[model samples]
Target: MAKRGSRRAAAETQRRRQTSGRRGQERTGWRLWLRRAVLWGGALALLGALFLGLAVAFAARSLPSYGALKATQPGQTIVVRARDGTAIVELGPSPGKWLDSEQIPEVMKDAMISVEDRRYFSHPGVDPIGLARAVYVWVTGERRLQATSTITQQLARNLFLNSNRSLDRKLREGILALALEAKFSKQQILELYLNKVYFGGGAYGIDSASRKFFSHDATELSTAEAAIIAGLVKAPSRFSPTADVDAAVDRANVVLGLMREQGRISASEAAVDPSAVKLKKDVSQNSVRYFTDWALPQLEILLPETFEPIEVWTTLDVGMQQAAATAIKGNVPRGAQGALVSLDRDGAVLAMVGGTDYVATNYNRATDALRQPGSAWKLFVFLAALEAGYTPEDRVKDVPVTIDGWSPRNSGGSYAGEIDVRTAFAYSKNTVAAQLGNEVGFGTVASMARRFGITTPISTYPAMVLGSSETRVIDMTRAFAAVSAGGNSVEPYGIVKVTTTAGDVLYQHEGRNPTRLVPDYVAAGMTDLLQTAVSTGTGRAGQISRPVAGKTGTTSSNKDGWFLGFSSGITTGVWMGRDDAKAVPGLQGGTAPARAFAAYMRYAVKDRPVEEFQTDLQLPEWQLEPDDEYYYGGDPDEYYYVDESGNLVEPQRPGPGQSPQDPFPADGEQPPAYPAPRQPQYPDESGQAASDDFLDRATGARPSPAPVPAPSPRTRTLTPPPQPQQTAAPRPF
Candidate 1:
């Protein structure tokens, strides 16, 4: 029984051991499975966290840099104003002032927030809920929908991004919006958005919108006005009051409803009739159209890439400009046209009239027209003569002469009989001028013209001495201005200073010290002669109450007429002619051009105190000593000597079949062997003799002229001749 029990016990014990072993194996397997499940869950969690981290890094790399985000800037308007700060015209696409958050009204702010982004103050530049709603609407509704871009996102788009409907653009906008929120406070972001938002009619910013819609400042805006401005942001042109008043009013009503719903405005304010809102009339047309058109290109040149509003203080004098235009229109004939340019001694254009009416013709004749100046160009020739050691009191014969197969006749068909140089210039005698031009080299006259700011190319022909060359009226005006400035060369300019609205100067005219082109004695002498002409000579019509001096010019067949004159305070030039260069009957420089000049000057100098021209009346002493050894040292017998009587005697004529040799050149062209006379290098304020004072300082060498005949007291009188076409005075005063 024990063995059996033992055997049974062993078997039972073995079975029990087996059963316990089986239970232990089962428990171990369950524990292993639990361990494997926990490990797998932990591994999956780690993988997800790693993937999320990598995604975040990639997104951060794709974002704009911090510096780029800080570089956001909006376009600014360029405002050109008169000297007194009166706005003349505004240039550029945006016309508005930058308003600070404080300058903006609370009503405006509330209206903008209520309509644009309700949770603007709470959200982080992007509204997730609004975007989700937009997506739901887009999926469910039949109409297309747009994603909600916060004010910050809108500002980013306006400043740095283009408007494009795409996922990539939206991602960038959202990234920029978040970056903006991170960089700036809520108030700063709102202020930037208010200033950068676009309104209709080329207006940007809340202040500009208010001014455009209500004709008032943003700070003065009412709740209704604010609502209307807020509604313009979505589609500025579509909601423009100038384009569609009804549509704009409806849009404003929508904004007012939203404002009322958001508790931004009272019920009474929201209930205001949209049609009763007094919208301002658009003053889009600039008053100073001509001046702005003239100055626009210059502004572009000063700032090639202007992204902000600039303030340009120009040299335009409004009163004088109007007066000039009035004078030109009133005096100019119905069929003919006229142009006038009036400038101060400092080359500031006080007044300019390009045509009779700017609306009739946009062509700016004052700066563009190139016509024959006729006797108006004689100033240069007279200057050349002065440099050649000839005085205004010197005598020259006025006789009909032919040179180079071209014979020039005087208007009267009669000789003045050995007239003085001053009388010849005053009477506009052509023959004497031709003789004088031949006497003094034409090259010298051309040089003097260039010195006086005449940029047109001058011909070497004697006819050119009579103002046959064409030149712009502005250039002629500038040339006369140099003379008025006491021989200082002047470059005509209009712009004075250009600055940003922030007062940062972009460009400023740095006027150079006046540089003298002629000696004071020469200028004074010329002024004296010109005064005589204006007072009693051909240009007598140009006489004003105060002492005035000018020259009259009439081109061939009366195709162009001109008068250039100056006072101590101002210099003006007037030109009259047809665009096609047609001859006008009875047109004379003394008649029409002189009259126009006087008319404009009468108004131009009305307010200014009378100022007299600077004059140094001391005459140059004449000291001539004979020297047989010439500087040219060519033919000693060819040289013609000036006698003590101041008469230029002619040498014996060459025999027949032998070309008559001229001792000195008859044409204005300078001889290569003999160096031409030097002009003033630079002007001094005191009109002192500057560099190479060849004229002011005397030299021992005497003037050795090639033989020329002295003026005869006796000449044949011609019959009364047929009246020729009205032309420039054969002699420019």
Candidate 2:
């Protein structure tokens, strides 16, 4: 038994030795493999490091030198100011008054960091966690290449890089961000970022933005206002309070929530009332930008090109501009746009509203849009007639007439035959205008329009007598300003002077001289007709506290409505129409356009002394002798005329053959006796008819007459004029 145990122990020892040897061999093989694997991994890591280093070098090679990057230059800055020296707008990259770190509100900084970069101060230049998450989101198609740029990185990009999203750009941005961090402290970087970043509407710094939107300094920014401004850094144009206040307020709310979530503010502080955010009164009036934009192009001609900042003193009257804007906003119908231009007798532009909203569109309808003037073109036609020796007392027949395959009829469809020139003009009888156009020749009419300062091309077509030629509101307003200036030609001008910020005059409007476009007698006669139109005829809606001489124009199919009038040394023009020239339902020159003109004129002339128009010509009375058959009701003794407020007023009866006359007649003689009243007649059915076609073809729909409001308590209550009976003949205007 002992011998067997010895043998088994020997075998077991041999087996154990063999197993231990195999185990040792396996351990030695594993260690050899581990060393090879470690060497390969080390080499791969070195290659990657080399590649990364080369990329860094390549991106850094094209970067501006540190000094050059720090020396950033802003673009040309042009400050447009109103006549009163109020800054209207700043054009170009203006680095507004730079606020130091101490001046910047803490709320502003907190809001920006909370919304833009939560880990801004802790990160060197780029946050690894944010970068990784951004990459993951981009790769997984969760967002369109989300930007995880830190505030430092944003400052770097704003200072030295273009906004390109390529990997190379990102690499350059990252490198520049790190360099910026190394060069400047956190507060300095934040200050630079706040001052350099764009806040839209031509504002570049927080100070400028605050002044522009809040009408206050950045030092006075409330918590809500700071949030609003901080949120604009992401999308300035889209979040601009002037462009879209609701959008800006909503974005600010998001910023406020972020501030609260980051413990920068309390939940109660995060709750912001959008109504508390009010844009500056002037800032809210974006219509002023239209004038600024228009005047900007004129600056190039006024001064030599230079990088020095310029201040252009324009003729824009802020009060008048606000009045015009308010008038248009309150009166212009929905789905349509309105434009107004007000000029002094010397042609200084006092106010201009280009469209319904300048933010929605920058198109300057007052200066850029060319639309048919409708019957407002008749001013030129009648002025030509007066120059051709026709007096306001002269008679013209309103019979149906065809000229060059074009037939013209009145807007009322019926005509008052054998009416005096003053009566025909006040009533806007298209037949008489066409007759005058043919009698005086189309060239004479066109020449008269050009003489009055209409710069647009004039067509001499017979239809041109009815204002078929497309013209701009500015040009038409200037033409009327000539009459207001005693027949002197007016060149509409906005810029009074252009100077450097140092007060050196670059340009001044001093050399131009006024040229007499027409004789004072002709102006008087035209004024007589215009006064009649406003006092008792179609433009009664345009009357103000002071006397107004104006004309009403409604284009074919009512696509455009125009009221051009002059009162109290100011000539203003109002136009309402669709941009696409589509007809506005229930629109007419006698309606909204006339009311808007009156509304603006009431405010514009409120402070100015009331001045009466020169009526020296032997003008006939505007009263239309009532037709016995058409006279519906009321006593003949109650014959009335509409006063400035559209109230009916009784006139003093004249002695036999002693009619009312101007105190200063041109010939120093009494005006002619009143002509026999005529009956209203329809177009002759047997008259040779021409195609009733012209520019902006008429829909042959008779326009509804201007609505007369209920009489005031102090005014005489009289019977309103009988409504014109509609006929089948096509309406001409």
Best by lDDT: 2
lDDT of 2 by residue, 509-577 (tens): 873688988878789989989999999888999989789999999888888999999998999999999
The weakest ten consecutive residues by lDDT in model 2 span: 711-720
lDDT of 1 at 685: 17
Q: Please write out the lDDT profile of model 1 over residues 1-733, one tens digit for every residue.
A: 8788889878888899999999999999999999999999999999976874564455556656644643444555678777677777775555467667688888889989988999998898789889888889889985577887899889778766888899888877777677677766798778878876888655778877777777777888887778778888988767777667787789989999998999988999899876777877755432245566666688667666766768888877777777777777777766888888888888887777888765445577888888889888888888777665555666666666543434556765766766677777888777666656665666777878988888877886767878978899999998888877767787777788888888999898888888889776678768877877898789999988998988989887777888899986699999988888888766778887788888879888888898876654443322011122222233544444434664444434568899754334345443223234222111121432321222111221434343223311211111112222233333332
Candidate 2: stretches off by over 4 Å: 1-68, 71-73, 90-199, 205-285, 618-733
lDDT of 2 at 448: 89
**Clashes within 3 Å, all models in order:** 15, 0
Every model's TM-score: 0.54, 0.58
Candidate 1 runs further than 4 Å off? 1-76, 94-289, 300-304, 614-733
